[model samples]
Target: METLKGKTAVVTGSSRSIGRGIAERLAARGALVAVHYATNATAAQDVVEAIGKAGGRAFAFGTELGHEGDAERFWAEFDVQRRAFSDDGDTGVDILVNNAAVALRDHFQDATVADFDRMVAVNIRAPFFIVQHALDRLRDGGRVINISSAVTRLGLPEVIAYGATKGALDSFSRILAKELGSRGITVNVVAPGYVDTDSNADWLRHDKDAWEETAAKSVFGRVGEPEDIGDAVAFLASDAGRWITGQHIDASGGTRM
Candidate 1:
């Protein structure tokens, strides 16, 4: 339907998995997508090729988050690349999806200080500053969707620290929504549960018992897919979601319900 025709979107950590799904969906809706990756130039380019083959426009950008000046550098790179695809001089972003994060599977007792710091830096600090740095480039009516985890609401012993970071992101979104309301910008969070992505493939693909256990968390008796979460994000980025902001929309397929 081209609901997002003539829009520009940036999806972080979009080289693979859930981020890739979101990037593709936004492109399919007619938005020119900037797929951000921390490393792995090959993988990022693969995503761009896939999108192009599917009749979508996209470009890949590599920037390591969780470091000083990274966010500013990211925008600079985006601005240069965006001009290549844009005929008009408009380099502002219409949608910003902060989907990059670091997940440390360390329990409260097992978590190391280093692990916690890395997670906090990547998951919380990066997104926080990413948004702050993007304020000037974000269109007045832009959409900000920060990907969170269902673990924030549910009890996940393995990723307790990781979940906390997402909780913080949710809080940030809520306040930012109110703060940006006057500008007509919408900020929201999308939390996913037990998604079957490459990050989980090592455990899920090898062990049938473990896979079943994870899938059973959802009332639908199945694990969530990248597209499932992507669909939710697409809705939030659409004009239909204009009335909604400062909300946490669960894309977990009724997990633990």
Candidate 2:
């Protein structure tokens, strides 16, 4: 349970939903979490407050991760906070969850270069460079969990660009695991299917019949929650998953054929 004791984790896009769930889970298991958000300062602060209230250590951070030198700037601010608070002066992160992503749900023909570029920037480019910037700080035997989508396997319509980006992430997870295994660093992907987050709340509420139709595909007979994905991430980040790497675990309850 204390497998992550004395560790520091950074969860990107953690202001709400899946990212928030992952951050909470890591903090609950004894890791000091940095809740990173692109915007929404109040929401990010709320997350930090909630974690603190729950007897966990956490901090709120903000960054426009897709711009030049943004990663370094973000780290500098993060370091100041860590030095001001952490008992040990180590800003080194032991867990990196690349959960920040932007989804573009459009048919292939409807997808524009702008949409594709945005997807690449947030989901693919940012994660790759974030890992690069954190490599030296990521202690050996650390964990990196990439959040991917099951749409890549299911080939969901109207999500071509989003699916493509997730596929790139999944591939990145496999390749990075092989490259980092020698250093005892573990890299894996948690691919989730149709989680009921704020963005999807409208659909689940107004489109009840359609939601049920989609839910029937899963053996669980219901949609997943952010916590469902979070639990899987916590397991992979724990000693319980030391032997697991170079793989993509579909947290999708038998939704894909």
* TM-score of each model, paired residue for residue: 0.97, 0.96
lDDT of each: 0.91, 0.89
Highest lDDT among the candidates is held by which one? 1
Residues 1-257, candidate 1, lDDT per residue (tens digit)? 68899899999999999999999999999998999999888999999999999899998888998888888888888877777766677878899999999887998999999999898888989888889988888899889999999999998898999988899999999999998899999999999998989988998978999999988888999988999998899999999999999999988989988
Q: What is candidate 2's lDDT per residue for 144-173, written digit by digit as tens?
A: 999999998988779999999999999989
Q: Which ten-residue region of model 1 has the weakest summed lDDT?
A: 80-89
How does residue 122 of candidate 2 score in lDDT?
89
- Per-residue error for 121 in candidate 1, Å, reads 1.0
